[model samples]
Target: MENDFEGRPSSEEAAASLRDLGADRQALADGVQVPKMLLAALGGVAAWWVAGAAGANPGENYEPPTSGWLGLVAALVIAHLIRRETGIRFRKMGPRAALVMAAIPVLCLILFSISLGLGSFGARWAVLLTSLSAFGLVTWLAGIAFRSALDQLRR
Candidate 1:
């Protein structure tokens, strides 16, 4: 109030304030580091889910994999841990991040289906490859998505 000229800031002052805010956002985004444990946990969960296919019976009388539910629970726990570790809760991680996140589950499902096929053919050993693939792919994609989310915060 003491510094008010005409009960409001000048246009230049407003612009400068906005620039400062942007810089602050950028700094906050830059300071955020993705937790390695979060990535590994997610990757492990994905691998476990895909590996479940190796023991599943594909045809009639096939029982749904109980591992799916366990994996979902693990994922939820990871999400909570990530929030606590990061100290930032992202409201929206941007379109690219969203797409990458979506792709994770889709990729896992594809690998799981392939694993099921291999199991049906008695090639259960091949599921290990799919499980490893899921681990690597999920971890990489999760990193990408986290970076993209930070970029959104910078904006």
Candidate 2:
């Protein structure tokens, strides 16, 4: 038996279809090659999702990042599965990307003031702020690195 789609194609072949990977049905109906609106909308949604997950939560959690860790992990797992099933291009994520991804959650967790930890509401708030700042810095660096990596791949 012959399968039309034999798993993921090589980088060259994948690159050719990258523009249409995340496209919407409207573009397909319109017989367009590119999906500008879909790409923009997805980008905006992705940014908002990341920021919300990374930002502070409303619950007075005894654990700082614990409340969001499960949600974040779940989202990541779901995304991975969806991408695989949908035949999206899966890029090579090196140590740098893994480190940055892990850092986001761990950095936030560092602010957690346990029983023997930084002892006080005020100090906890301070730690929270510091954690947010550090997370922002790492995220900024990650954005640059991610963009550069994509540019290289595209080129």
Candidate 3:
């Protein structure tokens, strides 16, 4: 008599199927790179510009990086569009990835604050650094989030 599981695919077959799916996903990822980069860059610049208005110090007319709501909106919008257009496999991100994504912008804000306190470059340079760094961090974290989402699909 045949065992009930005998006709079922083996573990190796399951892994191979996953690899095939992963390759398909990789092909999709390759196709979206240009649009993704463009959108991310736009978000970075928009966020940097958004900070200029409120970040300004009336005494010296210097702007430092602050929480970037406008930029966040841009990034979130672009991220939504890209997710739809690219069809990245985000099957099971769970809590960890969600927490990381949530924390990245806050961490960037904290870093910007730290940069604002540095006196070595004076207020003007500090503001510039803070703005640029904050935007960079946002984009960097976006990349990490995308990669993490991709990783979740493979599992």
Cα misplacement distance, residue 13 of candidate 1 (Å): 1.6
**Which tens-of-lDDT digit does each residue in 100-141 have in candidate 1?**
999999999999999999999999999999999999999999
lDDT of 1: 0.94
Question: Against the hidden reference, what TM-scores do the models get?
Answer: 0.93, 0.37, 0.57
- In model 2, state the lDDT of residue 119: 39
- Candidate 2 clashes: the total is 0
How do these models rank on TM-score, best leading? 1, 3, 2
Angstrom error of the Cα, residue 114, model 2: value is 9.3
Cα deviation at 37, candidate 1, in Å, is 1.7
Which TM-score value belongs to model 2? 0.37
Residues 47-141 of candidate 2 have per-residue lDDT tens digits of: 33333333444346733434455545654664454445434443654566566656644544443322114334323334444444544554464
lDDT of each: 0.94, 0.44, 0.61
Give candidate 3's whole-model lDDT.
Answer: 0.61
Kindly give the stretch of ten consecutive residues in candidate 3 with the minimal lDDT sum: 50-59
User: On a 0 to 100 scale, what is the lDDT of residue 91 in model 3?
Assistant: 63
Off by over 4 Å in 3: 1-35, 42-55, 58-67, 88-91, 94-96, 115-122
Candidate 3 backbone overlaps, count: 0
